[model samples]
Target chain A: MYVAVKGGERAIDNAHAFLAEERRGDPAVPDLSVAQIREQMALAVNRVMTEGSLYDPDLAALAIKQARGDLIEAIFLIRAYRTTLPRLGYSTPVDTGKMATTRRISATYKDLPGGQILGPTFDYTHRLIDFALAAEGDAPPAPQASPLGDVPRVTGFLDREGLIEEEPASDATPGDLTREPMELPADRALRLQALTRGDEGFILSLAYSSQRGFGRTHPFVGELRIGEVAVEMDISELGVAIEIGEITVTECETVNQFTGSKTQPPQFTRGYGLVFGQTERKAISMSLVDRALRWKELGEDDTGAPVQDQEFVLMHADNIQATGFLEHIKLPHYVDFQSELELVRRLRAGMTEAAE
Target chain B: MGLLARAPADRLAALYPHISEHAVLRGPETGAVMVRGRQGGTGAPFNLGEMTLTRCSVRLPCGKDGHAYVQGRNKDHARRAAVLDALLQTEAIGEVTARVLAPLAEAESAQRTARASKAAATKVEFFTMVRGED
Candidate 1:
């Protein structure tokens, strides 16, 4: 006389409570404040901002806290929040030529107008865990200096000589990824947008894959610059452009030797990367992937490379989307599975009777 | 919100401000907002029902044809569809894919992963033991 159980509502409620408890952890330990997480775990905040496509650090930290330090989950939270906001007017593209740079490096040319500043980077650091961090020792703050006025872009120098390639400027406004669906054969702007909002880990791995001969495009980091850039918007009502705010951005351009195709002559092709925060690795990876995707536009033969395939490249570019579609199979697919089971059983029975 | 009360074209025109002028009526059903285009849904030979879809076809500045599909359950959905329709007609398909689809896909993916990881974390092993009488 046992009846089928039907306590799904209570079960869900208990599970939510358990999750809340798990998120808070122990009561005795000092709880990590959102400010602390934002300041101390800045890199995590950057990742969420870069991928989430939002520029709010506090919100990113709050999302990180809620998701229990799951960066992607935090990004998801940020995206969900961002989508609910009303559409504001688009901002004019920032002039990188006017960027007050902190770090500027060029692999192509050692001597540039603004000498390379190897500002805060892990490149020179030995890969050893600092024991002092475990003790939570108070580190002395470094001296700050006012930024040198307007550092001319490294690309500007190359553009004068016509030695470097020139990307055609289009008057067409770019699409918004958050509001629409992705189609095939994305242009440079669209590609860059995808790369900017793309998963840092996924982009890093893809860039690595390109280096490992999957879609090898010999790239020299032409210039990698990180600095704060002013964002300006045109107010149509007032008929005047106004400076809204400033945001940290990382810009990278990779120079690659192009063997002239039928349509063009031998020149150094460029791969561009731009991210919302100080994300150098993402910028570099983005540059590499960007170049790989440009093979078709450059009239190079389709080598059946993952990077060369526009549809494949664009579709798999976003880690969140790729992972979501990949993982959705695990959901309670009992209904779908039942249909499949019925089909399989009927097919098997038909085949057996035919054999008999 | 309301179906066409006159000619299918007039009804479609009426729906233009409500549903989407670009949308073609696939069929009719209660609570079914069915439309067909290459922009949304499972880009394949399949059928879907119970969607709040608005579609519109518009002429772009460069004299190019464009189509858009927005999913929702109201006038806002149609409005969004109209905006997308306008943009799609003007912008490059690839640009739309990157700027719009990719981000959405990323969010969808993150959600799916969270669900999967959570499910995986809760997995339990089942076992049975024999009694000594056996």
Candidate 2:
């Protein structure tokens, strides 16, 4: 009941022209370089990389600049660009154990192996606005110490005591969410992939909801580490797994409340979240949500919570799809709207005639 | 190779100065390599994300082929790294190491020390109280 129409080509072109002009802002001001954004606005770059599922800081910076600092839009640009690049190969699974950690902390332990290194975190900050930053003041040098020798994951302690659930090593080739369409009853691999790239705000809300008793989850931050880990690949030509590069990542592991039936002994459960770039908030939130989704595997009751619903979480978690459908409403839908209006008018007219 | 992947694109050029003519065998092409992570620190593997990687292969006039797989979208970095990779396999390896690899390694270590220093500043120290019997 709708008609097709066209002929906004010139208007569309001019709109883009105006968009470019607006993107530049005042002619008097110096233009911001991609390098500046990459370095200074690093957290923003990390968010785009994590959600866009691409680890290129330069492209993420460029996307941010082009999108005029709209992060979701920047993520869209990165996602589009990734499709253009041909897949070279897959890297060996990164070893977090061998990470050159900058910031590592465990809430459960008072002090453990690798110790608690606060690294760069805003947790202790006063949150007061620093006017000195407005004046471009330089920061004083941070004190140096002898280089750290070795850092181990906090989970190892619980593992040694056999207090926490153990996940045996598996060499199974996990599913790729990007290449394959969303299949129902998606495994942990696919869910983690979706969660890693999911909208940060959405995941945060879900995690918050789970904590608020919508779903029963007593979560504790066992450890959260932000650092760089080498990405390696097995090369047939070289006959060895060569280190390609290091990617900055944030990894979070949560120890949940004990759960066991008559057949099984009580053991602390765990949830994990690993993301590209130093994004601890997203990583922690992802871990909480991940644990919430594991209600089935954990043999917990179906709470009917939004976070527990895999269909809802996985389907709408993608910001690209969510934003596309959402923003599309603002576009010209004259024909569709007109048809609806006409039908309403006809119904009203028929009512009038019947009344008469 | 880790140094090649991590080092800045311009730095590689600065170290090498000049390279003998070489033929491009494969790419100085940018592509993606899927990065994988584990369940806990060590468990079932899953796809974490994709990184922008540039891979290149070059053949020197002396028939030595060098390959480089770097971390970003800089084709020039890949090319220079590839050429150096080939040169390192040749008689000029000692010179290349002194100029490029050694300097890069020193810088990498320095940077690591700096980060470790900052992190070390924040390392928590705990004190336990002991009870004295009366």
Candidate 3:
């Protein structure tokens, strides 16, 4: 039972005012612009966009700014704002094969077509604190070289000999979680959607757990690429597909060990993760979780693992819902607690009398 | 239309002839387009996420209608793009392409080349030997 208490309206208003003031910080410092956040703190914006399930960088930057750089709070604001906008229509499925790739690499091979272009990675960088960055100074420009050509997917090589599982193309439309209520025993598409937008930390931990032998799949990174793909929409008025814009995305494909089933022979299976912007961590994590979740599909036993528990993962992955349930205790539970208090006291008195 | 939407509003304004009036057939209102991606990048379509976009539908006085969808909430960009689209359908298509699309495409190509060059520099060198195990 719950009661609506009607006090502290002024207090609430004052608290909000104080919050706004605090958000501004010391008056001496210059204010941070949305553009700066969008450009400088790009990874933050990327995470917000992927988890918030929105594609507009500017909106994500604005949300990040308003939330005082609290990412989950920023994601919450984005989701709240997202629900208000009317959905115009659907875009034609983006073709990532034609992506103007900035970064392309494969762990399965030492070298692949288009070579391993490690565009702006932290892999080789020592984790040393570069104090030069803290004070202020411009870094030198990266050297320019002749552009690479034909960055093909590593999975395609295995596909040539039918060594890897074939995921045949289809024109069928997959489920939309935003518009529809989630149903249990979801297909791969639905599961991918949930994982892609799930909290990064939660997904990361789960991925880490799977690798730690909970529900190991013996995963290998077949390919990881970050690039821009054009967004095309079939406009009815124009009677053609129009390229509205382009957005950067990171895609990770994992080749996992697959034991033979009664219906099929031994072959390498694939786990995929594609997310908006250069969010390789989330993308890679998403791929690992995706493979682990495919236990049933692959004819492997569930092993009673948390990774294999689709319902648990999907239902609790959203930070907004999880936080709402956990944070609601902060609200006044006066009546509920009062009843419990009386019951406890009465029970104690009865026990004392019985002892006498 | 794609090139028009991608072009800057100020650039479009400067290049295209001033259209006195046009019927606002649809909207210069902000909405979202549900972006879909393929399964494993080559299979069944699944909803990726919604992208904020502003769209406009306009018909010129000469009856050449245009529709455009531009990324983000800039109503002016959407409207200008739509106006340019309508103008392109008219006899002035050649002039519009020369003035607007050509210059925009050149600039875009230049930017793409610059980015690709930077990326190309980071490609792995096969000849670089790893340290021998102790």
Number of the top-ranking candidate, with lDDT as the measure: 2
Q: Which stretches of candidate 1 lie over 4 Å from their true place?
A: A1-7, A143-147, A168-170, A342-356, B1-134
Better of 1 and 2 by DockQ: 2
Report i-RMS for every model: 19.0, 0.8, 1.0
| Best first by DockQ, ranked | 2, 3, 1
Q: Write the per-residue lDDT of candidate 3 for residues A1-356, one digit (tens) a residue.
A: 58988899999999999999999999899999998999989999999999999898889999999999999999999999989999989999888888888898888998677788899988889999988889767679889999777588788899998889987888788888997888999999898888888999999888898998888856889999998899999888668888998889999999988878888889999988989999999999988988899888788887887888999789988898887799899988899999999999999999999999
Clashing pairs in 3: none
- Model 2 misplaced regions, further than 4 Å: A1-4, B128-134
Candidate with best TM-score = 2
lDDT of 1 by residue, B1-134 (tens): 11111112322343333432433322121121211111100011111001122333344445544333322223344333334445554545466556554554565456434433332332223357878894
Q: Could you tell which candidate, 1 or 2, scores higher by lDDT?
A: 2
Error of 1 at A242 (Å): 0.9
- DockQ of all predictions against the true structure, Cα-based: 0.01, 0.84, 0.76
Write candidate 2's Cα lDDT for A200-308 as tens digits.
9999999999999888776999999999899999988979888899999999999988669887788888899999999999999999989999999889998899999
Q: Candidate 1, residue B117: CA error in Å?
A: 45
lDDT of 1 by residue, A185-210 (tens): 65565666777788887778778878
lDDT of 3: 0.87
Locate the minimum summed-lDDT window of 10 residues in model 2 chain A.
A1-10
What DockQ does predicted model 1 obtain?
0.01
Error of 3 at A154 (Å): 0.9
